[model samples]
Target: MAVTRQLTGIQVRGLLGRFDHEIIFPESDEFIILHGPNGVGKTMLLELIQSLSGTLRIPSIHRTPFSEVRLTYSDGTQFEVSKALQETLPLGEELEKQIQRLIFRLRLPDGQEISSTAGFDSEELASPRFRDWASRVLDLEPVGPDIWLTTGGYTISSLELLHKYSDRLPTRALRTGGGKVDARILAFLGENEVHLIETQRLLTLEDPDSSEFRRGSTRTPAVSKVESFARDLTRRLADALAENSRTSQELDRTYPRRVLQAHTEYPSEEKIRERYSEQNELRKSLSAISLLDENVGRIEIPKKMEPWQRNVLWTYLEDTEKKLSTFSEILAKVSLLQEIVNTRFLYKRLEIDRRRGLRLVSEEGTELGLSMLSSGEQHELVLLYDLLFNVQPGALVLIDEPEISLHVSWQKRFIEDLQRISRLVKFRSVVATHSPQIAGKWINRMVSLGPGTTD
Candidate 1:
C-alpha cells in the first residue's frame, strides 16, 4: 500500500477574487491558528482544503471561488488545483453543454498535470435514481433538471446543492462526474486523511444510515450529539469488555501449567511490591471508567511467602496485567477527555458509565441528562469527543469557530487543550476563530488571513 502524505502548508490566490492567503504549519507545533476577520474566507479556505483532501468529492474543488489552491505535503511534494476562467452560461442551456462548462486542472507533484471539464451531467442529476438518493440523503425534492426544492421553501441548483451537501452524498453519488481526469485526481489525492468540524457542532443526524437533514422542516428529526456520543462510547466499552473476557478465559485455562512449570527466577520482594502497586493503580483508573469492576482497591502483598506461593502470585499478576492492557487506549482517551471537560464545567462532573456511555452528574449528586447541558457545554463535549474518538492518528483536523458558545475562559484554554490532545493523539490541527482568547499567548502559532498577506 502507498503511504498518504501529511499536509504541511496551504496557499490560495484570489480567494473570493480579492484576498490571498498562505499558511505554513510549524514543524514542532501541531496547532495552526487562523486569525482573521469575517468575510475574508477563513471558513471558505478550510472548506477548500477539506474538499481537496481525499475524503471529499473531486469535482467540488472546481466549484470553490478561488483562482488557485496549492497544498504542500511533508514529503516536499505539492498538489495544485486551478480553474480555467469561463463566461457564465445562459439559463436553459443543454445538459450536455452544461456538464462540460467549467474546466479544472490538477497539477501533480511530478510536474505532470491533468484536466477535467468539471460538472455533473444534468441527466444524471435528474435521473430517477439520483432523485431517490437526494430524497433519502437530504430530504430534498428534485423539482427540475438542475433544481432542487428544500423543505425550507428554498430552491437550490444542482452544483450549489452538491457543494453545500457534499458531506451528505455518498462516494458513488459524487463519482457520477465520470472522467479519466477525475479518476487521476482522485487517485493522486486519495491518500490524504482529513476531517472537518463545522461551526454547527451540536447537531447530528438522527438516522445513522441516512443523511436526511432538513433545515426548516418540522418533520426533520435531530439529536443532541452529546447524547449520541454517549451511546457510541457505551458500545465501544462493551466491545472492549467482550475481548477482555475472551483473553481472560484463555489465560485462565493455561494458568495451571504456567504456574506449575515456573522455575524462572522471581523478582525481589521490593520489585514485586512495586509492580503490584503500579498494577493496582492502573486497575483503579480503569475501574473509575467502569472498564473494570469497582471492587479494585490497593492490594497488599505479604512480605513472606513460600516459593510456590510466590510463583502463583506472580502468574496471577502477569495475567491481570494482560487483562487490564485491553483498556489502555480507551483509558487514555477517556481520561484526557474527562480532564479537559471537567475542568471547564462549573458545577457538573462528567463520568464514563459502562451502561450509559457518558454520565453527567451535578454537585449535589443529581444525574443530568445530555439535554441539561448548555449549548457551550454541549459544544465543548461534542468537539472534544470528535477530536479524541472520530479522528485517526496523523490525520489533519480542521476546526471552524471553536470559540462559538464558549465562555472567555474556555476560549483561553482551547489552545492548551488542543496541545494536550495533540500530544496524546498525534494529529495536526488548524483552528479558525475570531476570539483573541482562543489564541491566548500562542502568537507563534497564529496564521493571520487577510488581504494581500501571507503567514
Candidate 2:
C-alpha cells in the first residue's frame, strides 16, 4: 500500500450555530472515540469531516450547517471550508436552492494558501437535460425527488449520484467554476481517502456498484453482503492461485539452469532440514485454510547428505518459498478474520472452503446460511470485512454508533478488537458512540462533545 497523508486533528465552530468541537487525535493511538449526549452534533461532525476530506459532497456539506471547519493533516497541510449563511433554510422545494456561498481554502506546510469559492450547479441537477442523460446513459431510474435507483436496484442520493457520474458530466455541472485552481484543490482532497460508516450499519453504506450492492437487492439484506464477500474472497483466492501457478511454472522452467550455475558450498544438513521444516509448516497452514488444494505430506529428511544433494534441496526450498510468498498477505487477513469472528461466535465456527470462500458450520454438523446470522453478528461480520478489505491503507475511517444492535459484552470488546485490526491495517479511526462500553478503558483517547463545549 502506498503511504498517504492522514488527519491529525479537526476543529469546527458554529455547528448548528451552537456546538463547537476541536478533536485532536492521539498521535500514537489507533483510534479515537467521541462520546457525548444525544443531539450534541457528534454524527454531524463526522459528516462534516467526510464531506470535506474526500470526494466532496456539496449538498451534504450544505445540509450540515456549520460556520467553519479546519482539518489538519499529518503532513502539516490544512483545509478550511466555510460558507455564508444568509438565511435560515425552510423545508420543501425552497430549501433546495443553491446558496453558492462555500469557500474552500488549502494551506500547505510551506505557508502557501490557495482559496476558491466552491459550489455546485443546482440548475443542472434539477434540469431535465441532466436527468434524461442520467436515466438514459447511466441507467439510473428516478425514484424520488433527488433520489435515483441504481442499476443494481438499490437507491442512491443525488449527492452520491453526482459523485459517481462526475467524470462524464458537463464541466460547469458540479465544478466550482474556479477553473484549474479549484480543480487542483479538489484533486488534492480526493487523494486523502475517507470512509464514513454511518449509523445505518444494517444497510449497505458504500456506493451501489460495490460487490455487496451489485446483487440487485432493492432492499439490500445485510447478510447478502457477507455472502457476496465470501464469494468474492473465493474469486480472489483463485486469482492468487493462478498467480502462484504462473510464477512457479516460470521458475520450474529455469530450475535446472539456475541450479547448475549455483556454487558448490552448501549449508549443514541441520540448517537445511530446519529451512525445509519451516517451509513445510507454511504449507500446512495454507492447506488448513483451504488456500492450497494439495496435502502437506510428511517428508523424510536424511540426517546426512552429499554436497550435491544439499545444493538441490536448497534450490528447491528457495523456489517453494517464492511460490508460497504470494499468499502471505491474504493469509494474514483471512486468519485474523477467522480468529476474531470464531472467538465471538457462540455456537458456530467460520471455515474457509475453496468452493464457497467461507462457511459457518454449527456444532451439530449443519452448514448455516450467511443470512441466518443475527443482526449483531451480521454487523460484526460486515464491519470487519469492510475495515479489512474495502478501506485503503492510511485512510480515515469514521464509524458512527458502532454499538448499535451489539451485545454489551461485544461492545466492551469493540475497542480492543479495533485496536488489534488497526495495528495490522495501519489506518486512523474516529468513532462516535453513545455507549460507554464501546469507549472501554481508553479514557485519555475519549473526546467528549457536549453542548457549547470545545474539546
- Give per-residue CA lDDT, model 1, range 1-455, as digits (tens): 65656787899998988988888985566888898777899988988998877654555564567877788877666777666543332323432232223444566567776766554444445567767767765778887767789989999877677568655554444332255346776676667778899998787854433223233333347777888899999999999899889998999999999988948687667767777888878888898998886455345578797677778778888898898888898899999999999999989999999999999999999998889999999999999999999887777899999999999989988888888887788788999998989988888888888844343
- Model 1: per-residue Cα lDDT at residue 205: 59
Per-residue lDDT over 358-427 for candidate 2, one digit per residue giving the tens place of the 0 to 100 score = 7889989899988788989988887887788777777889999998888899899998888777778878
Mark the regions of model 2 whose C-alpha exceeds 4 Å error after superposition. Answer: 1-4, 85-98, 122-126, 131-172, 205-223, 294-300, 452-455
TM-score of each: 0.85, 0.83
- The whole-model C-alpha lDDT of candidate 1 against the native structure comes to 0.77
Q: Which ten residues in a row have the lowest lDDT in candidate 1?
A: 91-100
